[model samples]
Target: MNLAARVITELFQPTVTVALLLLFSPAVEPGFPGTAWFGAVAVLFVCVLPLAAVVLLVRLGKVTDHHVSDRRQRAPVLAMAAVSLLAGLCLLLAIDAPRSVIAMMLATVGGVAVLAVISLFWKISGHAGSIAFATAVAVLTLGAPWSPVLLLIPAVCWSRVVLRAHTVAQVVAGAVVGGGVTTLLWWLLLELTVRRA
Candidate 1:
């Protein structure tokens, strides 16, 4: 892979999902003590623990790549990640965190569920899907001013192709699924919680 593609792939690795959620998470709010704690929990549960699970799967010979490059190995890892995300969602709800945070987090979990089902028959590019979802959520939460981030979707799709990790069709499917599903869920939840009278 060329350095540019490699760089883009690295920058948008699945880890970014966690980081972006934390960045946009309600934890940034100043007044709520619970919000700050929820942020920490988000990092630990959404990012740190799930990443540790990936590492453990690698070390245990259960997965062939850091990215779970082998399609066959993805189900167990994705299922575990989904469960972890659901747990994080529950924790946020139990603490009465804002609906936006909960919605974004659910979108993340929902993405994994969608990916898991698709992985059973196809090797969709997780990187492509994740970037698509992230871009959509960032724009949805931050408004049209943040729309430029959508450019990353094509960039990531190209990187996956360049690296030979996924084909053009797989990348395309991932972008559609990731962007479509996440955008729908997030918009619905945010609309219900924020926009509706």
Candidate 2:
């Protein structure tokens, strides 16, 4: 890979997307309501813990890279991630957290569920999928103020292609799955919450 692609891949990894979106939750309308610890619990369970476990796995040779670059190794990792994500979702839901946080968690569950299923047959671009989803959330939640972040999707896609981590088709598929699922989940959550009240 060339220097630019390497830089892009390193800079825009899936971990960055998770961290950025969670942190950015605060600037939008009604942010993540409740106590300040709400954000802490969210950041810890939803992002940090699973990420740390993955990093430890890499260090212990349970996986190859942060991306889980090997197709064969993806399923177990993704399955575990989905469980962690689901657990976090349950926690947030139990607390009666902000609607947006609950909605985002539901979207994440949707994305991971899709990834887990796809991993059985092919290696898809988790990096592209996640960043696209995060970008979509930013745009939907914060409107025009968050438009610039949408650019990250293509940049990350290019990096994945350039690094040979994914083909154009795979990355595109990932983007579609991530963006489509999250958008649907976000809209559905909002609409359903309105109905329940």
Candidate 3:
């Protein structure tokens, strides 16, 4: 397959995107407690849910001998995107700063949208995206606590590459999608909320 196709596929992978969002939430908002619960929800919605859906689809495909194609695989990706949006909303609710929630949610969604658009047009390397995300986190962290959770994004990206599920570019695109979206959301949420007040 071409690099563009591969990058899009990797970007759409539900697991990587969702995991990145969850990992970065705490890093962005230190005052928002209950990282464990956020992590748990992310795991369930982002990882387990898509996995279960994949299993069911695989079983159905086998029973019907339906040759699974890229379109079929897109179901999980779509689910991941939906989950990421929901997770951002949940994170907004979890936060104590009412003024920031909406802006944060907007930034989160906007970032993901931008990443999706970019993935559609360009092929990104895995290391590049991972490094970008890590750097973004590091930059965002200048004022917040040094969160161990930040490491999870790279770990998830590595797993996808090691499993041969995605190339370096694809994984990196996923990282970009994950981090860019969340960061945008956090900033927007803060700004809008503050403005209204």
Whole-model lDDT per candidate = 0.79, 0.76, 0.50
Best-to-worst ranking by TM-score: 1, 2, 3
After TM-score superposition, the amount by which residue 83's alpha carbon in candidate 1 deviates from its true location, in angstroms, is 1.1
lDDT of 3 by residue, 1-197 (tens): 34544564356454454455455555444445544455445455545665565567678773221111233344344446557567656764675423333443455456545554554445333333433444454556464565654665666556556655557777666577656655655655555665445
- Model 2 stretches with alpha carbons more than 4 Å out: 26-36, 194-197
| Model 1 per-residue lDDT tens digits across residues 61-113 | 88887788899989998888887888887888898877667767776777778
Across 8-77, the per-residue lDDT of candidate 2 in tens digits comes to 8888777677666655543433533434355556667667877888899999999998888998989888
| True-vs-predicted CA distance for residue 9, candidate 3, Å | 16
- Candidate 3 local Cα displacement, residue 91, angstroms: 14
Highest-lDDT candidate: 1
In order of listing, the candidates' clash counts read 0, 0, 14
The 10 consecutive residues of candidate 1 with the worst lDDT sum are 27-36
Of 1 and 2, the candidate ranking higher by lDDT = 1
> After TM-score superposition, what is the CA distance of residue 27 in candidate 1 from its true location, in Å?
7.2
